[model samples]
Target: RESNNAMQMVEGLGEDDDLLRVAQELPEPSDLLESDDDAPIIRLINAVLTSAVKENASDIHIEPYENRLVIRFRVDGVLKEVLQSRRAVAPLVVSRIKVMSKLDIAEKRLPQDGRISLRVAGRAVDVRVSTMPSGHGERVVLRLLDKHAGRLDLSHLGMDARTQATMDALIHKPHGIILVTGPTGSGKTTTLYAALERINDNTRNIMTVEDPIEYYIDGIGQSQVNTKVEMTFARGLRAILRQDPDVVMVGEIRDLETAEIAVQASLTGHLVLSTLHTNTAVGAVTRLRDMGVEPFLLSSSLIGVLAQRLVRLLDPATKEAYRASDYECSVLGVDPADPPTLYRVPDGLSAGEGYRGRTGIYELVPIDDSIRTMIHDGAGEHELERYARTLSPSIRDDGLRKVLAGDTTLEEVLRVTRGD
Candidate 1:
């Protein structure tokens, strides 16, 4: 919903031109996949694929109802219908996707999930395919996992110097659990991979267990979770520990058993990196406790928490500085004597040029002996947050720094941070 509002504020830039360029760069469909070349159906499918890639669309949707089939691209979190066609061609296009994904096209009554690798614009794209039964026909949704997102290291993830240094120290620790917390699509996976990359060593055995392995990094053994085969996160991590690994990356701690195993791994002299679905760093303490992880274990083996959110960066070409408002100053905890500076995109700029990609705003909470004692005593989330403020900077302060540096807008920071 937040991203939809952001995209609605401005329109896409060079949309038609992006599609045209991708179409020209494509080699024949026969070369890319085992499909009949020179067929109109193949041409339409190829055109859609290249166009979606050029726009950096995260997902492509083909929805069929009573009469027409609508094709929409989820660009920057919002769904925009690019092309609409008759229901006649919908089956052919969806079938082509299923073939590439190695899914059973004939069994459309039951929902199916599969993956396809497509080389578009000279880059390999891992597309996650899902098909479900609808009123009139089937709905095909393709989630594109572009490797471009995982290419970033910590230095390039839009974090401040102090926060980055704190993270570096936390990740390099030989033993302890460092968890990244945020909602879905908050770049938690990218941050986890980046932290691992910084401390990754050939001498140390580092392994990761992801739901569906998204990024491919050499020298790292990645296992995909297959519930069908009884290979869940808990089972996978238990197996990985027997191999004598120095570092373990559990994609996410979804359940109590997995969380308990991750904490146990940290206590047993391994650096475990993972993510939690929490809004703030302090909230993680309460969340884990609610998940049945004992408070004593959390305080002992926990290293630090880095809560982050990705906010769209302002276009440097059109960035404009403005004075911070009274409410903004209060929220940032800035002194009125020394007013804080803020930045944003000037009005009248196109959405394409309004903001470029995104940068991260983080709240770094490094646990100290005092904070640990508070946790051990079963402190509430509010108390932990107040105590943590003395040990680290608040997320609001980090957002203000970005606004002062013209990296993002005040509104955007508030949106991602939930105005806390």
Candidate 2:
């Protein structure tokens, strides 16, 4: 079956002879700069894109090495090699992608970022294209943003009843900052979008300043940062505040200026939503403090912080029930004598291999009066974390809960929450 799938992918990209023949038949220099609707390269690229969307891939990688050109797809947060073609065809494929994204195909020396908005299988997809120079050739990556996937509600975000209730209350709060902290590709943007969707009633003026708007939703004013034109997160956020926005979503708080602006915005009256690159919920406070935000300001403006990670779910058809070891039971906070029935991704399966799609494991920390007091007093991360444990489960604990409930494997949870 795997070989058949590979053959299909190869056929989709066409054989090397077909690629070479089409490359030579191209219309000199000018046609190469334009997207030819009937071109073989166009069909090959489209086929790859269509397959990616159909397979629910998050990113498409076109990498060229000394021996061959490789195409990979990141599905369920794992990259898999899907196809390989002739090394000589690397330039043609890279140039075609650059042309399609409207980037300077001739400028192969520097990095470039662009976007492609297209429909595949009747579903709208927004592809963020990035190209970088390599020894063999230019390497390109396409980040796929499925509009349907972006519409996930909070209830469908793998949050338990209590966590969902906490999230609902936090997002509905009139004023204060609620942060979704996670590393890149950890579904931070999706969570923020879900919160915005929940509160978007057309009565409130919702506004956002994103590095690049990933998904489009009606009734919300979305602005993209244009650094070339002096528009950055801080600058765009400043402009958003003046627009009479009831709620503001900053894609990320990267600098002290942006963090201060977000804090001030929340203090002034608008509810603020943003993300931070942190390993845990408590670490977000320390990160902001390190960014020069006053502890008091952070305590006052912060309402909640949700730390999340994506873990691949087990394939129910293939998963087998097993017994948990003593250490596993201890980690899950269960007594060894009453170890729960656990499930794994089959016995012979190798590590880093996925069983099915991915789901979120989250730590939702709602800052209460006591926690607020702790933060206002400049409490350390260890202290804050110790307090947070009393209110909600840590990210790893949440993952373990999913493990106990048979949602995912213990290994999958530990894989994502290794830092914790």
Give the winner by TM-score.
2
Question: Model 1 over residues 1-420: C-alpha lDDT tens digits?
Answer: 212321221122233444434434545444544545524454556667778887788899989868777888887655778776666556776786776677898998999998776666555677788999988788999888887644659999988788899999998889999999988888899898888777776878999999988887778889999999999999999999998999999999999999999999999999999999898899988999999999999999998999988788887777887788788778667876677767777888755457767778899898889989998999998999988888777776787788877788888888877745
- What TM-score would every model get versus the actual structure? 0.86, 0.90
lDDT of 1 at 368: 86
RMSD of 2: 6.0
The superposed Cα distance between candidate 2 and the true structure at residue 207, in angstroms, equals: 0.3
Provide the lowest-lDDT 10-residue window in model 2: 1-10
What TM-score should be assigned to candidate 2? 0.90
The alpha-carbon deviation from the true structure for residue 393 of candidate 1, after best TM-score superposition, in angstroms, is 2.3
Model 2: per-residue Cα lDDT over 18-54, one tens digit each: 4234444545434554644535566567677777877
